[model samples]
Target: MQKSFLIVVIVAIVGGLAIHQFVPALSASIAFFAGAIIAALLFKLLPSALSQGDGEYSGPMMTLYVGNLPYRVHEGEVKELFSQYGEVCSVRLVRDRKTGRRKGFGFVEMPEASAQQAMAQLNDFVFQERTIKVREAKTQDSDSTEKNPV
Candidate 1:
């Protein structure tokens, strides 16, 4: 918090000076406000930048749903692609039980932080001439309908 505040103050002062040079009529307050806004925007991006890259992040594992995959792609292929972002715990590509054919989707399990990075980069990414989507898996209710008897 302090770091961000310092950055905002410094940027605001510098920006105010620059603006005063270019436009003498503009108030210093307005110039500082503009710089402060820019600084805040940059600060928002800081977390995302640090989130990417290898680091020991202690958190629960996350499961992600991958969709719109090419039928030709295998589980290993998907795992390999996702592993680039982090350690992939597991990858399971769904298939039709009756025919044992590909269903063109899968689930990938990994650390939460890495999973976030993967989702950001992989969502809407094109692979093998097809666009793919990556998102958090929707968990089913623990109290299943069968247990309650509708």
Candidate 2:
């Protein structure tokens, strides 16, 4: 499939040059070939943007909402729960900073592929007698709405 696309691109460029007998038509043909080459490259590579980039998303982080955790669930337990899917880089239970108690939610970080796998497999799996809600962690910037102070 990719080879076919490459061949088509080369043909377009060659055809453009062959038809370059008239100056105006030649320029348009050259421009069209250039556009086709770029478009083909982008089509072949667009899917990789979701998984590969300039370290923009190294590991996929997940935010989980846990319920009925026996009021004794700690970071360790969260790590243990998610460890079944992949290496747990970090587990942070949301807590009242002053009170230092779990707020029924937490975040876990793992490799991007592993995180995605975990989410698909564990989104509603039961744990510690309660169903959990697991998904990609949304950054603070993403959650906040821009307010235009008029």
Candidate 3:
């Protein structure tokens, strides 16, 4: 990981310098493109290498549906449970606004890599006589029940 980061930094500097030296007029454009390439490579490559080449996780904020949470479980407990695997960015318990009571499920957001690890380690594991379900949260719009209201 260190080696890759060093290599990327070196390439960015060398590329920037070469472009500036040979094409003074287009130096800005050349430098911008070179920097962009380096940034993308670093973002896509660094995490994977750090994880011993397991490959980096990608994409936007992911929501994980956690079921089998003890009925008395709260947001803090949820965060604490997942924090063991990775940083828990947020834990939002779905609840009724009127009564402020849980809906028996929640969404958890963590870095994709951490989320993947958590899923592998936690999914289907027995908990208080109920098998927990950990999966990528599905969007409401994708629910067929919502699209075709009875």
Candidate 4:
């Protein structure tokens, strides 16, 4: 398995380089697709190939539920605020679908350690005239229960 995989990788690399050198017009597009293919193979295929147990892979990134964001707060503002603690991967400010308005809540993704630090410092922290609530985002089931509240 390992030998075949290595052979395939070598063939792909050689083919890509040959195309890049001989076909200048198509090089850019080829490079773009080649990079994407390599990334998918490494991140997606390699993990499953290596894992022998049940297919469960939890990444190190943590997503936080941010509440009480002032209606004015945007993704960049939230990212800047959270970046003080650690690297902020993404910030998503939830918006109303019908009216296209800010929903006063959002989700932020960061490394696990950074998330903990941000949550500890920012939970209930007053920002933009509102006390912001920061905590780990709940899974779908828990989120539904909270909303329905039976």
* Top model number, TM-score: 4
Model 1: ten consecutive residues of lowest lDDT: 48-57
Could you give candidate 4's per-residue lDDT for residues 48-99 as a string of tens digits? 5544443332569899999999999879999999999988878999999999
TM-score of each: 0.56, 0.51, 0.52, 0.59
lDDT, candidate 2, 71-120, per-residue tens: 56778887887778877777777787899887777778777776777888
Of 1 and 2, which scores higher on TM-score? 1
The local distance difference test score of each candidate is 0.84, 0.66, 0.76, 0.82
Count of backbone clashes, every candidate in sequence = 0, 0, 0, 0
Better of 1 and 3 by TM-score: 1
lDDT of 1 by residue, 1-150 (tens): 455566667867787788777988888888777777766676577755533443545579999999999998998899999999998888999999999989999999999999999999999999999999999997766447647766
- Sort by lDDT, top down from the best: 1, 4, 3, 2
Candidate 3: stretches off by over 4 Å = 1-60, 127-130, 144-150
Clashing pairs in 4: none
Tell me the tens digit of each residue's lDDT in model 3 across 1-150: 565566567767777777677778876777858765865677576755444553334455567999766667778877887889987878988887898777777889988888888888889876656677899888887797788988
lDDT of 4 at 70: 99
Residue 147 of model 1 has an lDDT of: 71
TM-score quality measure for candidate 1: 0.56
Q: Judging by TM-score, tell me the better candidate of 3 and 4.
A: 4
